[model samples]
Target: MSATTLLLVTLGLALASFAYGRSRAYSVARLGGGVRSMHSLPSHYGMMVALWCALPALAIIVGWKLFEPSVVSGFLQDYIPQSVYEAGEKSVELYKNDIGNLVDSQAIADIQDPDKKIAAQQLASMRHISSLALFVLALAAAIAGATLALKRIKADTRARHNVEKIVQFFLISCASIAILTTLGIVLSVLFESLRFFQEVSIIEFITGTTWSPQTAIRADQVGSSGSFGAVPLFLGTMLISFIAMVVAVPFGLMSAIYLAEYASRPVRSICKPLLEILAGIPTVVYGFFAALTVAPALRSFGATLGLSVSSESALAAGAVMGIMIIPFVSSLSDDVITAVPQSMRDGSYGLGATKSETIRKVVIPAALPGIVGGVLLAVSRAIGETMIVVMAAGLAANLTANPLEAVTTVTVQIVTLLTGDQEFDSAKTLAAFALGLMLFVVTLCLNVIALHVVRKYREQYE
Candidate 1:
């Protein structure tokens, strides 16, 4: 049997076990006069039985999967010719790979080499044996566990307690997995960035004004030494992000405030979802709009004003990016603003304050923390954005504050560097990791500042 088929059979058994467990609990309760005499609910007893039935079988399946490959490989090694082994481990590995592929493709009959055909046949036989063994073992384990749990389903059994403990352990395991996964990602990025820094000076990467990352493969080639300066990337990222924030924050916040405080219920209902529809539009579409429409419009307008504007300028990208993020800010801010206690607004009104005054002094203060969080999220979204920038803002690492000029962001360059076949050992490829590390640091700092602001305001509001 296949693993998936076996898994379905196990689950089918568990379902049957649940019904039997519940019936057993009812029978035990009848012996004690009524279900009220039981120590736990019938559902809890059923859940306990289901857990017992599935857990042991699942454990066996997991352990089998982990060890099956190595065990099969070890058994297959005996079939390899002595000459192939003497050729070295690499040659033996290649021979094994060939046999495995033949088995997978079911092409062992087509093989001309007698030894390889025999090896492939053996591999197929072993895989069949392994699957059959697993199916039998898992079913046996499930039946045995369910029978044991069903026998113990007495009126006085603490089935609820056991089920709760199992659930708690599962939740804790999930939390630990998430934390460990994050730690692993950070460590991997840090190690790769360290390798990159070994090749290029960290100071030069951070502070140098030029941002060329092209290193020639040959020593005698022109421009063989590449500049790893990241200042231009940093400035471009900040300039575009700043422009986006300027466009998003005011418009989004004002729209949120009007929706939460001033608009009638009908108007708010109609407008809110319409406003949020902006978020549903894909970023690539926004990129197209910026590149094909907004950028050209800006260029024409600039020409009328006797000013030079690049066809792909940061302003066009930033403006479209801002429009894309408006819904994020508006939706979040609206929720928070609406969540502010009505009693606070009533108190402000009792003090003879107008609606606008009460909103400005009382409602907005209470909602400021959430608004700040929303803005921070939008800013991070802007910084990490790639498609919109790539399509609208041309990839020129120019160190200029002018939004009218073409520029590139750290994310764009990182994507550019890692797009094709790259040697990880080279500084050019490793630079992507270094850039990723810097982006992580920047985002972490933003989170810290947002937290500080949130905590300070939250204390007063609370």
Candidate 2:
């Protein structure tokens, strides 16, 4: 059958299952109508049956789709003519492509020989038959399962509880998909990094002072051994992050404090969202702003003070990133501070403490863990930020503490390494993975520590 037919059949079965389950649930409840009724409403029973019917069958269909192509291709290769089968790998690949095109187009013009045209038609027919068989089997299983569930519905059935548990499981599965995707990405990076390590020593990549990634394009080309020292890039990232934090934290914290503790409801209603507008601004916009405005301003200001400042400097990028993160720090810290019980503030006020004193001595300490958590989260964001650094901070990795000089970062290096046409197996490409792994590990560790601190502080408060 066609895909459209299969879809329509599945949809029909699902609707039928829902109606059947609902009828059965109502029937059971009506039998016990005088006093004791069903554990759940009829609609809940219907939903439960619908989910049971659709979920497993859908899962099977998805699994089949994932592996069916490879299985079918392997089987079809055996049916090819011996002459075509004995061809080189490239020729075999070309023949497979031709067959696929013929199957898709459903036309016989490309196959010049009558025998080959007949064989192609036969193979295409077999493929369609296999697909139809799978679809029918899946549909039957779904309908059967749903029918059984409807039969099982009775007055004493815990359909509501079962349905709720299934919903919770589905939600957890959705969350796990995101986590699994991250793990997949990390593993891919690690495997490629391992390949790179085989060609270049870890010692050289990590400890070398130079930072050139450009290498000879051919075997006879000159200046081929590119340096991969990561120290300067790391320093640049740190420097920029520090600058951004310095810019954002004080203003963000002050705004949070005012909003949470001092500001009236009316003022806060307006100011809070206004402050968040900074966070909403696109990072790419911030990038160009840093490059065009902030960098030039800094250069002119430095010249006045007899200081040499590069137009594209870590200071400019870092400052912009800090401004970008201010909202993150302020909003989170404000919420945590606000969450501290009102009784704590009241007791401090009773002790003759001023508003500022109560806030500093009682409120801040009580909310310290949450505030720290927010700060740590912001720090992680700063470390991984790419756009501002890519635009404002120059690519030359200079291992210097001077923020005035141009600097590169781990993220910038990764971008540069992976950009353009390059071999994946090369050490340069793999370096990006190693850098990514390090960045991931650092952020992961920080998040863990922050969680632990927050949990411990919550226990103390309780």
Candidate 3:
């Protein structure tokens, strides 16, 4: 049977087991004192039985799926010609791939080679036998588990405790999967970055000024030696992010304060949703707006002021990015500010303080930690943005702080470096991993700072 079919069958059995277990629990309870003498509720007994029926069957299905391919491949070895094996491991792997492809494409009847034809037929039969065996075994296991659980459903059984333990184990397994996935990503990047540093010095990559990453494949090719300095990328990223924050913080914070503390109910209901619509818009749409509308407007404005502004400049992208992130700051800050206790504001009023004084002294201080968290989230969003930068801020890695000049960011460069069919052993390709490692470190530092700030204010307020 297919895995999905088997799963449906298992679930059907579990449902049946649940109904039977609940009926049995009621009977056992009636024999005592109408569920008062039972150790656990009827629902708990039902849940325990359903879990017993499902868990063992699901485990067998999962284990079968995981190792089925290797087992089948091992069986295919007997049908292969000895000469194919004598060729080498690569040839053997190629032979296996061809067999797998033929099987998957259902072209077994069209097989021209005599040996391959026999092998394909045998492979099909083996898979069918394996699947039939799995179906039978899963059902048997489910039946056995349900029977054992039903027998144990006495008045003294602790069904609730057993169910809770099963749920706890499942939750722990999920958390472990997430942690291991993150660890794997970090270790993979770190290893590749170490390879890159071997080819290009870490000192030169970090400290040098110019930023060109085109390395020629051949010795006779031009620019065989590439420059890997990341200073320009870092400066461009910081300049754009700084501009974005400058535009976002004051506006977002003010809007939040007004909506939370001053605006009437009707106005707040209408304006808050309208403002948050900016966040719902796709980033590509924002990029298009930045490139077509914002960048051109900035250039025209700068021209009127007798200033030279590139068609694609940092200011345009940053401004648009800031506009895009406004909802993040506004919505979060408004929630935190609105959550402040009413009695504290009343106390300020009792002390003859004005509305502004109460907000500045009592409300803002109490909500400072949450406000910092919101701003930190906005900062991270600005730093990680790629579409706006790529569209409005042209990919020229010039190391300048001027907002009117064209520049690129680390993410854009990472995308550029890994864009085409390039050899992974080259410095040009591996530089992406090095850039990723640096970006990770920078984000980590930001998180640490945010944590410290949150802890400080939380202690003072709470």
Task: Judge candidate 3 against the unseen true structure and give its global Cα lDDT, from 0 to 1.
Answer: 0.93
Better of 1 and 3 by TM-score: 1
The residue pairs that clash in candidate 2, if any, are 244-322
Order the candidates by lDDT, highest first — what do you get?
Answer: 3, 1, 2
Task: Give residue 401's error in model 1 in angstroms.
Answer: 0.6
Please give the CA lDDT of all the candidate structures.
0.92, 0.84, 0.93
Compared with the true structure, the alpha-carbon lDDT of candidate 1 equals 0.92
Q: Supply every candidate's count of residue pairs whose N, Cα or C atoms clash at under 3 angstroms.
A: 0, 1, 0
TM-score of 3: 0.95
For 1-462, candidate 3 gives per-residue lDDT tens digits of 799999999999999999999999999999998998999999899989999999999999999999999999999999999999999999999998898889889999999999999988888899999999999999999999999999989999999999999999999999999999999999999999999999999999999899888888766788748899999999999999999999998999999999999999999999999999999999999999999999999999999999999999999999999999899989989998998889989999999999999999999989989899889878888888898999999899999999999999998899888888988888999999999999888887787777788777776665
TM-score of each: 0.95, 0.87, 0.95
Candidate 3, residue 304: CA error in Å?
2.4
Predicted structure 2, TM vs. truth: 0.87
Best by lDDT: 3
